[model samples]
Structure formats: C-alpha cells, structure tokens
Target: MKNILYTVLLVIGFSAAGTAQEINWVSLEEAVKLQKKNPKKIMMDVYTNWCGPCKMLDRNTFQNKDVAEYVNKHYYAVKFNAEGNEKINFNGREFANKGYNPANANRRNSVHDLAHYFSVRSYPTIVFLGDDSSLLAPVVGYQTPQQLELYLKLFKNNGHTVFKTQQDFQVYAEAFKPEFTN
Candidate 1:
C-alpha cells in the first residue's frame, strides 16, 4: 500500500513538472508601456495560421527551451497573428481587419495596418523593434532555434546598430557568443 501511494505521488509530481506554462505574451500596448518602464526592445513574431513554416517556427523554434528562455530574458516577446482580429493601436494610428474576405475560408483578415506599416511581405516574419517602438527592420523567412538565438543576442547587445551591412553582421555572427542562457 505504501509503494502504491509513493508511485501515485511520483506520477503527480512528474506531471506537474512536465507542464510548463505558456510564455507570457504582451500586447502591443502593454509592451509599449513596459518599454517605458524597463527600456527593453521588442521581439514580435508575426505569424499566420495557414502558413506551414509559421507553424513549424512556433513548434520547432519558439517552443525550444533555449529559445524561449533567451527571448523571455532579453526582450518583451509578442506573438502577433498577422491574420488575427485583434485591434492594435500604434503611434497614434488604429489598425484592424479592413480587408477581410468572408467567402474564402482560407483568406484571413486583411493584413493589419501595423503589419503594412512595418512593410512585412511574408508570413512568420520576425520584427525587432527599438524600445521606442520604432522599426529595427524585419527578418523574413523561417529561422531555426540557433539562428534566432544569434539575432536575439545581437539586437539585445546593440550589435545591429553597430554593424552597417549583412556582411558586417556575418562577421559578427561568425564570432557571436550568446550572452543569455537557457
């Protein structure tokens, strides 16, 4: 009887340990507010549900323990659905679903004005913003967990502003060491 009780307790403990709470995602407004307080940059994952690579990024890259820990530590991470219905206000402008197609099930709501404002041309685009919510350039295409780590560390350490070109970044990337740990 004692052995059975011990086994049950162990199972409960393991289950609790395995279930990690999802990352605490901040809304654009909340992020801006937090930026005023803490002065950290913003990392926005702009994704669409219909995009396979976006799903893969969420599953394989963002969900990785190292990636999550690094992002959570360095930046105010935000998951913004490029096709979602949430209203967003930025820089005295209101962005919403202005071009939604009701007939096409796969057609998502119109790209939010904020997405257009950032000039995002693809799904799963990762936009890194300055502490003042200014554009720091959007990185297109899918990135692996390690690849994203390089960018996170660079931007967090102010390397992006220091390097002038992709070649310069490559030089930095080659010698890059991640300052944040999992």
Candidate 2:
C-alpha cells in the first residue's frame, strides 16, 4: 500500500517525478576494480540489515531520482552490508567478520573488519572515498535527499578538502546551495 502510494506520488511529480534511474550500486571490490578503468569518487552506503534508519535511507533518500542520478554520474556507489559476512579487499588488505553468525544475519551480526577499518560504529554511515580510494570521511545517521546532497556534492567536487577545521566546514555547509530535489 505504501509503496503503491509512493509510486503514485512519484508519477505525479511529487518532489520531482519518481521515474528516475536507481543508483548503480556495485560491490566495494567491484567499485575499486571499476575505478581502475574510470576514476570517480566512491560513495559507500555502509548499512546493517537490522537498521530501521538504514532502510529509510534507502527508501526515502536513496530512492530519490536526483540522488540516484547524481551518484551514478559522479561516483561509484557501493551498497555494503556492514554486518554481513563478506570478504573485503581494501587498500591491499583483506577484511572479514570472523564472528559473524549466519543465524543472526538479520539481527545485527558481528561487524565486518572493513567497517572497523573505516571506524564505522554506527548503523548507517555514508563512507566517502576519493578517486584514489582513500577514505575521505563518514557521515553518520539518516539524511534526507537535500541533506545528503550537501555531502554528495561536497565530496564530488572535492569541496571537503578545503576545510581546515570543523567550523570552516560548518560555514561552507551553511552556504551550500543544494541542487538535488526529493
């Protein structure tokens, strides 16, 4: 019922039509491999299966047409399951969740070593990486399309590199003109 209503609203151009292409989410490893051929920043949606906000991020923010289009064009989107038992090869190192119990897959299993490497302790952290695959920063929690746009564009344009301090970032954020809708 909710999905149908959303589709209806989207078709009616609610927050700019919902008939947009979805983000081309690839695996982190695949993203790295693709980066070798085509240089682009990486936007990793590090989420856990049990997180409510993570699900909302997908349905409410990531589902937005503008977000999907912008991400697909300017970044290699990675939808990583933070607690899943997947082996990850990042920066010449292999990572895995040695403690992950398959039975607790949907109930918050052990954190993947890759999450630990990124210092992600939260459920839905948006980990940004440069074209060289270097960690830029992680924006924690759920963000609306407009809210996430700030970070998306900031990183996409290398705007995050100019901040000398947190206050500097606050000023830039305050002056940011968000172009993404819905």
Pairs that collide in candidate 2 are: none
What stretches of model 2 exceed 4 Å from their correct place?
Answer: 1-18
> What's model 2's lDDT at 86?
89
Question: Please, what is the whole-model Cα lDDT of each candidate in the order they appear?
Answer: 0.82, 0.92
Candidate 2: tens digits of C-alpha lDDT, residues 38-85: 999999999999999999999999989899989999999999999999
Q: Which candidate should be chosen as best, given lDDT against the real structure? A: 2
Off by over 4 Å in 1: 1-21, 102-109, 177-182
lDDT of 1 by residue, 86-169 (tens): 789888888986775655435565776778888988998999998888888798989887788888877888778887788998
Please give the range of 10 consecutive residues that has the lowest summed lDDT in model 2.
12-21
